[model samples]
Target: MVQHCAGLPLAIVVLGGILATKNNSLNEWRKISDNVKSYLKKSKNQRPDDVLASSIASSKQKERDGGEIAEDVAESYLMELVESSNIRSLLFFNEFFPEEALEKSLPLEVLNYVKEHEDEVCNPLVCIFMISRAGTSCLKARGIWRYMFNNFKLLRALNYEITRGDHSVGFKLPSDIGNLIHLRFLSLKDLKFSWIKLPSSLGNLRCLQTLDLRVGNYEIHVLNVIWRMEQLRHLYLPFMCKSRTKLMLGTLRKLLTLVNFNTKNYYLKDLINMTNLRELGINFPFNFENFNEKELGENPFIIRSKYLHSLSIITQWLILSIDPRHLAHLLSSCTSICKLSINYARISKLPEYHYFSSHLAYIRLLGCEFKEDPIRTLEKLPNLRILEFESSFEGKEMFCSAQGFPKLESLILGAYYNLEEWKMDEGAMPSL
Candidate 1:
């Protein structure tokens, strides 16, 4: 049955199992054999086993040193189709080539086949091209980018990372990148380019959802173009040409994740406009000495983010001390917040009259000082399940006693330099 199935190893194995069944009979066997034979004859003017062997042979040829046998056979088949006679490229052969061997080596014959059959290639499959080098010299190789971009149009993703080596040379992206309108994800990391001006045609990629560009030294003007992509969901901007620029929240309302906003002297008001933002990480300037408790209370950035669920601020103590009123307002706005992390440089007294988040399930405080009455403030958080305090100083007699946490389940305290004892209620101790 395997032989009759034109060497289709999978079909042969499956049929062998069926033949071993008790219900299998001579008539059933005959029917299966006849169907396999018919399928082979219809596929080509050869036995099914012979056709499968030919396919294997062609695949092997393409895999081994980009041999010409596969290309010749594939080209012949295409020419005979007459209907697709104009199609010259043998990309199909390239697709069938073994992937493992192709990574460390490129077959010249395969390249030649693709070039010669370029006109014949009618339908191209989605392909990913990745280039990464440790040093800069390798990135300067000529014609590499052009050759790849010109030949590959159905690219779904492109990731290129290169570092500097000898001379300060910059790399350039292929000019025809716009042709790959189907691109969904693009990542250019550590590229040596000094100034990258995105092609306006980038907006044509209506399907693009992610664009990541990271360079050590570059004037990135492509952000304006990226902002036009309505489908964009994730954006990472470690550095940009313009400093002290305010991002329009309306333009990035669709963004769900943003990172590396490491800018100097920027206002939080710029982010307040992003109504749909779910996760945000930014470094705001800190001036502990000049901080005004009243001015911090008026900060509009904290008042506008009504839909925020997870927040990580530079310092919880600074914000709380600078403006406890603003902190209270910010906490009140985020009723849906589930996770909160605050890093304070120094310990500050907690507000006397404060409301805890009803939805908060996880909280982490680092490098902060907690008073002896730490549990008193935490008692307001009815839903807190996990709490972590790292490298923090808490007053003595700070124990998980009955009056402290009634519903807290997980507690982790590290480097509690001043912690002496933990208090827990007689019967309200959490089931840890």
Candidate 2:
């Protein structure tokens, strides 16, 4: 009996279940052993689980007046079990696994597999979470998402993380996706140099709160219909050249976080009414030579909301410059900003503002060459907790005075090739 079950735990458990339900007659035991052996002989190349499944199916058929079950009918039943088990596994697994790990592996496989067996899989249309990775997964097949969207009307979130290595096989979003009014969160990341075609129908997702599209090197086309998504709370998109169309975004009063957006054709005034905004990320386009810094600083478009706490600016080109005076205006505009990140901009001197916001706690500077010592200007921030410098500042010496950065906890300085000297006074960065 042990040899017939091959000593596998799952097989033993299933056989035990079968034995528990049947009469303990020698004839019944012999019949079950023979059936298992016959199925094992037929499924030699398949997994042991497959053989067990076949044996169970044959036993059930024999019990039902010895009628044969159609292959399609049998497959449908097995698939139903698999679908239910997989969904439960995902829901349980998500509690322990990190979001990035879940995003890259299991969830993506489940979506594609369910989509492939759409007709046979039970409840295939209900997707609570879906993820598609690059190259390795079958979801990369062109228009697969579009076809799948027709089935997934109740989808809540969809994430796509494609590698930039294979630009030729980029995915597309069908206009039909807009029909999924229940969708609340969506993300499209890492489509380098690939063009993403957005449909005007995307604006129909009024229930959407999070839209993340921070592809490393790609251009996303937007339609004016985007401004109509009144329920948006977080918006993340790529920065491209100026669009001819205008977008009035201030009406999205519920918005809390905005990231990596282009402000080329749209005036800063369009965002002044977004009173609930807390975090802002801007990736300035390359054609900012014509943008007037003085005019922008004085413009009523300045963000004065107390809810605004984080600000980030990204620049790709070398010619794009941010003046010290303009920097001061930005700092003054958002007095409550706690976190600030400036990247790839040319700022020769630190802003003249002697005292930064009292609430400011974190500062990250990258690729912004400085002619003056930034450490001197930054050390006085009373509530500063985290300071990071990457390939920024070329000063010869840095001194940390006593009582500097009283609440600071973390200090990270990297890629400063020319920094030769550092001095720290007693009690400097006491909490660091």
Specify the highest-lDDT model's number: 2
Q: Please identify model 1 stretches exceeding 4 Å from their true place.
A: 1-100, 103-137, 140-143, 149-153, 160-181, 189-207, 213-226, 239-244, 262-267, 286-307, 314-327, 343-356, 369-374, 394-401, 421-429
- Candidates' TM-scores? 0.54, 0.63
lDDT of 1: 0.55
Expressed as tens digits, the lDDT of each residue in 1-432 for candidate 2 is 658767777666666655564457664566557555543343336677886677676656753542222432355346446645346443433323354555455456555775786664343423223233233133334344655577678999977665444444444566787888888998766644334657778888888988876765645677776677888888876555324575668678767788765557455665667776789887664233334756754543367566788988788665367767656666767878889998987789777535367788899999888878887788888888999988888788888889777898998989888889889999898898
Candidate 1 per-residue lDDT, tens place, 1-432, comes to 576666676556655644554245554466446444433333434686787676665456543542323434455355335444366765533323444454436557445644554443331110112232223443433245545666677888876655334344665555567677778787776666644665566666666767776665545555345556666666666454453354333456556566544324333444555665666654333222223667555643342544456766563123332244444555565656778776663435444424455777788877656544555676557778788877656677764546555567998878876767776667553544
In model 1, the Cα lDDT at residue 417 comes to 64
Model 2 poorest 10 in a row by lDDT:
127-136
* TM-score computed on alpha carbons, candidate 1: 0.54
Q: For model 2, what is the alpha-carbon lDDT of residue 136?
A: 18
Best by TM-score: 2
As a whole number from 0 to 100, the lDDT of residue 355 in candidate 2 is: 32
